[model samples]
Target chain A: MSTTISPKNAVQVEASAEVKAVHQQMLRQQRLNRAATYAVAILLVLWILVPIYLIASMAFTTPAAVRAYPKGVLPFIPFSFETMNFFLQSEGIIPGVINSIIVAIITLVLSTLIAAPAGYATSRFLFPGRDFYRLSVLAVRAFPIVVLSIPLAVVFINLGMYDSVYSLALMHTALALPTTILVIGSVFASIPFELEEAAQVFGCTPFEAFRHVVLPLVLPGIAAAAVFTFVMSWNEVFAASILTVQNRTLPAQVLAVLGQSSEPYQFAGAFFMMIPALIFIFFIRRYLFNMWGQVSK
Target chain B: MNEEKQSTQKKRKKINWAPYWLILPSLIYLALFFIWPMFRGLGLAVYNDEAALSLQTEPSRDAATAGTLPQGTQVEILDQQGNLIPPDEAGQANVITEVWYQISAEDADGNTVEGWVSESRIRVREENEAGAPTAGSVRTRIGAGDTLTEVYSEPNENAEVAGQLEARAEVAITDQSILEIWYQVRGEDRNQTVEGWAQSRYIQVFGETNTGRIDRGNTGQFTTEYLSKMVNDRFFWPATITTFLLMILIIPVQFVLAIVMALVIQARLKGNSLFLYVFTIPLGISELAVGILWFSIFTQSGFLNSFLQTTGLINTPITFLSADTRYWIIIAIWLAEVWRATSIVMVIVVSGLQAISDEVLEAAELFGASLWQRVRHVILPMLKPSLQVALILRTILALQVFAVVIALSGGDVVTVLANETYRQYSEFRNANVAAAYAGLILLISMGSAVIYLRMIRSQEEMAA
Candidate 1:
């Protein structure tokens, strides 16, 4: 609202003083609001990142420094891999990691395989029981893990499948299936149904239409769902601990001895568990909404 | 016309079963793993394993004793001596006579024992019955008692007391008394090969075979003792109250913080996607790791203390995770939960915010509404459904908070429902009590969900 009162136009100045002052006040207020927003946003970013950074420092530092009081916030002065290395070399760590990876892979395959067709059916077919199925899936998605794991553990043991990685994968699949179906269902819903119809009209069979036109578009979202399934299984500790004895997953293994483990082992173990998740989220950052958002709706 | 009418009738009669077929596997899987276990957990909460069978050497009532089998023991029927009576229209007794079967099974010592078990003693294992205890894997705890549990060399009370083991000691079932009153157990001593016998009543037999999940009694009779035990536990109220308190404290703060973060991203400022990524980073992190990460911060000589000391805000590092500082432990857990979980809420909120079209916000801006007014009037109302979803999600998860409390506070100073459930299941070897805790948690979670649903529905009605 600033008016130019140059010498040539001095007799023709327009904007009132009150209006200029009000405009200036409004601009200042907007600037203040922007600064506040940035401040809050950056503070939140730090809130999430700083703990991770602190744990990472503890992980990368020498074991001696990890135990020292008034510890350094950063690991740079004499960064050492000693702590993380010690954790990795420790008994059962390798086996635990192997078990975690296997279980996650199995869970990813099983959940995605089982949920894909269901997701497709719900999104496309408009079947009679579709709403009931979808609502139940939604309900089951929020089921407490404790209730499911304890009994399933008993069931697995009865079937003589307990303490095996795949048995755990089965349990993890059950946990992830509901969310997977909902997410993949929404993914399918996003693709236009007429595209599949057009492919069929062009002489592609229904299956051929699905395999060629629709599959290519939805594959990434389904893969993201699968990756999340893997992450869920990888990050889960309670069920893994309850369901398996010898075939403990990484989180369960770390938790099993966390009470007796030293500070370095604990920190390094936490950092190790967090690494895949951090990277996985980075890759699937585009589908964060696709995975979680539509489910909320 | 007749041909066309017939064809139309045929077309009308046919039903599409393709979608049903597509969803069948998932439905069955949920039925088995989700629905069945929930009922099984409920059953576990209500039942205790208290049934046993005495194996007679002969079919006669006066026969000599051969061995004993705990309920749920798998035995192969070698011979039968009586007819199976059918239930009549009057609903009379199904067994007309005392039936007996000669059965063979491996004993606790891996030796096969052959004996006559009466029909009344053995429940028929249904064709679809899941696997039973493989004859010798019974692990029981010495039930609560202050006095030392005296173990006899023989099943008889007159037999010499071989040793006295401490209460709450775990023992493997090596043998059982023929009279079904005592169990020969191998106690905690490592060097002792031959352990002694303890009375069955003093031995608390939770249906945990050596290598399986906790099972309720195979006898199929329900009991309220486990549920009562959970309710009567010393830590029950503290854990329950703390669980709810944490939920109450954490969820609102989380929603607010999440909304702010969501708004920041929605502001479309420079590098907001980077901010979105940073905020959602914790969505991938596990609760156990989050607990450990925060433990590193709040531990003695940890990051928080280090920072405070470096800045001269404190002279010495505080013992934040100790028993005397229980509130601090709770705070540490609160902070950890907030840090780890708010991201989920933020993502949901951001999506909800995105669904609000730009024109509505522009309309509000053109109407000269303040930022606060726009959020209060135009934004939050639109965000209700998302908020409801986030609230329910956060609350349910908050109830099940386990490792964070344990990791930060050692679970001694502060406890939650899930921790108590784990303690009952793993440490105490009491599956029934653990199931009780799990059932209680589920109940509360469902109650909260129902409440949230109703609240939102009512609010929507009010607005309508």
Candidate 2:
């Protein structure tokens, strides 16, 4: 009886030990997986951030450092704004910036104003041709700006608006409108119809319900859409380059002379073009998903 | 109760016109700006603003002008002279010998006139007054001989050999003539019908249409000159090839990276929010900035060289952006595009992943599926719709890639479709050709969009 019991206990101990070893191995594998994931995450982060950091450094570096061989990877070893200042002082830079700002603002305002009503109509009302309108907007949104700009330039020249800020603004508005409408439509759609009905139930008219109840809630989304529109206009080089000559936007101005420009100017100009849009993007980061979410759907 | 019924009836009878009113302004604005410009843009491909070419009185540049020959004018070339147009500053003159023809044709005002016009300004075609090949105009056949006649691709003698027409080979005359010697013909070659230019003397000639009329001027109305010009431009194919190359190289990598990024965020690990923000930082960065950033990396003495040298990886900084290393330039542009544009795809994937319920993934896990299996069988299947949308968006945007190519390589070493359009419009001062490029891009965009839709829909049907 003692021999049989001892052998069984021995077998049990061996089985338990094997199970413990397997559990430990699985844990190790999980840890390695986690480590790999972190490594990948970090690598990706660095991949994006490094290039930006290098450019920003070049933008802030002295002209000499910018032109130096085997340039520094880290930022601001001897930080200087001489290159940036030189770019700013360069001919046409100031006017170019001003034009870009003005065109962006006009585009933002005009596109938002035009799109908001359409956005509301699509979201709130079950109107005839609603599907048609939405699809058309989607189609137009994807229309090549390169194609649109050439003919628009001709029309503008015929209308005597070519090479002017307003013509570009109009083109930008056309570009921004479809996106604005789609984005704002999604923004309006996200709000419950019951809220507007509640306002009406409390003795408000349809317009009053929209203006007071829906408008306040949708403002942030519209602002997000407006920011997107502004960024679009600011970064649009093709149409701006084609449409304007003397009153060139910042991108157009930079691109026109980019071939001949030195290293310092190119880096500084790139940084300058990037900063405002980045700031605007940061302000609207919370709404990034909100803007693109429905557009994709 | 009767009053309530009447009011309800009134509400039902009155149509809701408010939505139409709301959408009207945008619709009209789109019509005027979006729709109108699109039609006009496409129209610019075919319509020529320059209606007529002045018929010079003689072959000399200083010769007095005869009445204008409207574009598309059919003229009888009674005489001909070759003139040498001097080369420009770039020494890239129109290398084809300039042949001027003395011809009689109706002027712009419909009055018959005799004039000499530059051959470059006209298309040559055989007269077809009877609207049929006419009597004795049997299909032209190669003259009987032991030797085969050489068919040229272009009407010019110096053009490449397209094919050889066998002796006694029956050919259809296409009514097109050029260089006063070559006739456009379609004939059977190696059992394949080939269209090419054959020397007129090598083929049997027939009909009073024997003397082909020269198209001295383009009919300014509905011309294909711009479209042809856009296609024939030296930069056109390179731009097209580069654009497609970047698209093909960048897209799959983007989708894969984007999926990984989405998964990383979805992992909900530590600092996931920070990862999300960092991954998306490039979203707001303009393409021009992205180009410059990559240029700084790939440029000689830039960060890449600095890192390589510091690590003792290389003895000298490589010239990555030069014309000789055009492949590197393309890689640089591809990297820039992947870096800057992947954020959008990542966001879309993240949103797609969000729409997918965790229950499906958990079920797969419960079924003992591994992580790879779970992703392949569960997550990816559910992510198709979102992936389709993202693909369409990325494809259209990829076709329009411009500023990045310009910034990285000055657009001279490597060109893309959008860059060529700009060059044609601005530098060459030809809006029509630019418009032609634009029209091509638009067509490609629409075609890809349709293809994506069709492909996904078919897949869905198969599943259903």
Candidate 3:
């Protein structure tokens, strides 16, 4: 074979072998990278999920299950609805959950209504007080609703509106307004101004252009803003606790009755409050950056 | 067509009335709800609301407060606002006005300190005030956080003990002896109506003072008593400092975690969005939910202790949420907050990272720069704006921290300024101090925001 093989052929065969070895090494490296990626992804997923799993386990299992010396992380033990049923059937909880929904809805509507225009104004046109408006939105961050709710409580009482969902909704709107305005403004800004201009050139009035062209484009962002506002209002405790007496939101009610209830009720209540939030978070995943990223830019 | 188009154009081409109109609703709402209330809160904090009546700590005319209502003493006011509501009926007997304050408040903070009237002198406002309780029956304010344990089945001093009653649980007396040392009482607790024999001497009995305490009224928005309560409230300084510290501590750590998370998610790997979705799932959970969920882990006999005990780490389950180890409660709360809110920073960082052009990174790599060097010189500088935003927002939100602590601590052993503000209004019935606390929080939050804003600005942006 050595006699039959020319030196050039031998050299070519050696080069081909080298190329095949290099290709094999690259494939192995790629597989290693992929394995690393999957490991990290799984680790992160578990990190995010394990707490939720523990909570869900507690909520679904019996009180004894929670007290188990070695607590089970998963809901593998026979499921029991007794805790959740008791919480759901409890007198204060139903109205509380409903009031939370109502308050959140009101917050969403009010924040969106106020923020959309304010945001649109800031995004579309530069006015004299534009910087002031922008800075003030940032400035509102300085004051917690805790401080504001005190005076608002008094005012709401004077207005004969204290301890009602409306007063609470109003406070929530104020809290939600700053972020809504900023987020929605950025949303509108991201849409090309040329789109609205194009609509106007085609015989649409400016308002008509916004209503038809700009609005549909910004709806998803607005929806995201609405979700954020809803989550905020739903989760809010301080203002709800302060501003209302009889008509308490879920978090406020939970705070009020926290000590009185048993542990199972606590877990159930906590898990119950999370149900709507879980659903909404899935809806708003794409818009989180749209909501938060604009601030930094 | 030309005329109509010209006319429409003329109407549209004028000053942009649109933006101002668009912004009006927000301005009006803010003015009505936000700005006005903030100003009023600050103003109300300084002004001493005229006392509906001057508060007398001792029920005597010397007007000495022997100082505020003594804890555990109860007052049955024939009239709460003796003469405040209807000035025309000043000093006159109008016994029907409602007592807006609690009837049997055990907690001193929950007690509205009107003026105190000594025993037997309460009906002195009138020859026979209709407001006085019937001859034998008496009102009682339970002592703050005191458990009325001896629920004897019989009225006798030594009877079979029934199940005990909880704190702040109240009852009406059906029968009692002189000085009411032992009384027959009944009250409802959750599912059952409880009848029990209790001793006035042992239990925290608040009411039936010969003279009632009157809250002249919150005439002076600022009262010395109110100020003292605000300063001295158990939760005041501790909560305030905790809130400040928690925000300060968590912001840096949260930023680090967020960056790592952002880096991980930005790895150009498949299913990275799933990571984003999972990580930010917590963002959706309310503070109440997070706190409660974590509480199950940290409580005595909870998951952590359970795990510890199972692993033979200790002889007994540790009470992590107990007042003796309240610092651990704060740590648990910090854990819950970090777990729930770090994603907010992560999302912002990811957005910032996403905005960075890969070309620049490749160029930096092309310059023989190491990953650390490139990250320091390029990535960090560009990520500054995002970090600043996350820092400012998180700090502001953290300063307003309320629900998490409430869920974990149950308003005991731990408190924050926001929680104190709530206590001032709801528990103490003092809105002025509540406002002041809020104002302080606002000042701090704004100050922090200003610091972050100034500190993190890029040189070019700062120069410009």
Q: List the residue pairs that clash in candidate 2.
A: B71-B218, B71-B219, B72-B218, B72-B219, B123-B215
Off by over 4 Å in 3: A1-38, A67-69, B1-14, B51-229, B309-315, B367-370, B457-464
TM-score of the B chain in each candidate versus the native B chain: 0.67, 0.64, 0.60
Model 1 misplacement above 4 A? A1-28, B1-12, B49-218
> Candidate order by DockQ, highest to lowest?
1, 2, 3
RMSD list, candidates in order: 12.1, 16.9, 14.9
Task: Provide i-RMS per model in Å.
Answer: 1.0, 1.3, 1.9
CA lDDT of every candidate: 0.79, 0.79, 0.72
Residue B191 error, candidate 1, Å: 42
lDDT of 2 by residue, A1-297 (tens): 999899999999999999899779878977887888999999999998777778888899899998887776566768988999999999999999999999999999989988999999999899778999898888888888898999999999887889999999999999889888988998999999999999999999988998999999999999988998888899989999999999999999998998899999999999998897568777776677776666677
Worst 10 residues of 1 chain A by lDDT: A1-10
How does model 1 score by TM-score? 0.78
lDDT per residue as tens, model 2, B122-230? 3344435854321111122345453544444444445565455333333333322323333443333245433333223323333555333223332356788888898
Predictions in order: chain A TM-score: 0.92, 0.90, 0.86
The TM-score of candidate 2 is 0.76
Q: Pick the candidate with the highest DockQ.
A: 1
Task: Residues B117-171, candidate 3: write the lDDT tens digits.
Answer: 1122111122225343322111233563543333444433344543343333342
